[model samples]
Target: MAINIRNAVIQNVTGNSREELEDTIVDAVQSGEELMLPGLGVLFEIIWQNASENDKKEMLQRLAGGLAK
Candidate 1:
């Protein structure tokens, strides 16, 4: 059987409130654990899917700027 980790992560956080989600993200980043990367990627994918073109461009620009540093 194939495991869909992205879907699993999404399901794990399903119905999370904005504050709860923010807390989860903050905790994950503060921990600096590689294990949390997949979950963060999944969250970013969701945001990318819902973002407007302008928002997407801004995100890309920010990411690029951060990477440049």
Candidate 2:
């Protein structure tokens, strides 16, 4: 059976508070585990979908700057 990872990630964090979500993201990044990437991608997808054009531009700029470093 193929599991929908995005849906599973969303469901896992459905009721998380802002701080809790922040902790989750921080922990995932700090761990440097490859398995955490799909969940992070799902979180980014949600943020990207809801973000305004200006927010998206800022994110893109930051991403580009980070990549350049």
Candidate 3:
């Protein structure tokens, strides 16, 4: 059977507060686990979908800057 990772990630955090979500993201990143990458990707996808064009451009710029470092 196949699993829908994006839906699963969303369901796991469905009712989280802003602080809780921040903690979750921070903890996932700090853990340095490969399994967490897909969840982060899902979160990024949600953010990208809802962000304004300017916000998207800023995000891309920050990403490019980080990659250059």
Candidate 4:
């Protein structure tokens, strides 16, 4: 299943500014706010949408290292 970026982005409640909305996403990342994807497919899509290839690779590496704990 595909997560509609249009819907995901615009369907949310109104906000004051773009900076404020982006800050919310940043906070979600830092706070490990798990997304409620329709399925794992949508989840992976969202991950790729947010991260470039290198970013995903680096994040995966760090995630692996963290998991070693």
Badly placed stretches (over 4 Å) of model 4 are: 1-10, 13-45
Ten consecutive residues with minimal summed lDDT in candidate 3?
19-28
Please give the distance, in angstroms, between residue 66's alpha carbon in candidate 1 and its true position after superposition.
0.7
Q: Relative to the unseen true structure, what is the C-alpha lDDT of residue 14 in candidate 4, on a scale of 0 to 100?
A: 49
Clashes of each: 0, 0, 0, 0
RMSD of model 1 against the true structure: 1.1
- Ranked by lDDT, the better of candidates 2 and 4 is 2
How high is the CA lDDT of each candidate model? 0.95, 0.99, 0.98, 0.62
Q: How many backbone clashes does candidate 4 have?
A: 0
lDDT for 36 in candidate 1 is 93
Tell me how candidate 3 scores on lDDT. 0.98
Model 4 / residue 16 / CA error / Å: 7.4
Give candidate 1's TM-score.
0.91
lDDT, candidate 3, 1-69, per-residue tens: 999999999999999999999999999999999999999999999999999999999999999999999
Per the 3 Å backbone cut-off, how many clashing residue pairs does candidate 1 have? 0
Of the pair 1 and 4, which is ahead by TM-score?
A: 1
Report the error of model 3 at residue 53, Å. Answer: 0.3
Candidate 1, residues 1-69: lDDT per residue as tens digits? 998989998998899999999999999999999999999999999999999999999999999999999
Ranking by lDDT: 2, 3, 1, 4
TM-score, structure 4 vs. true: 0.38
Among all windows of ten consecutive residues in candidate 1, which has the lowest summed lDDT?
A: 3-12
Whole-structure CA lDDT of model 1: 0.95
List per-candidate RMSD values in Å: 1.1, 0.4, 0.5, 5.9
Model 2: weakest 10-residue lDDT segment is 5-14
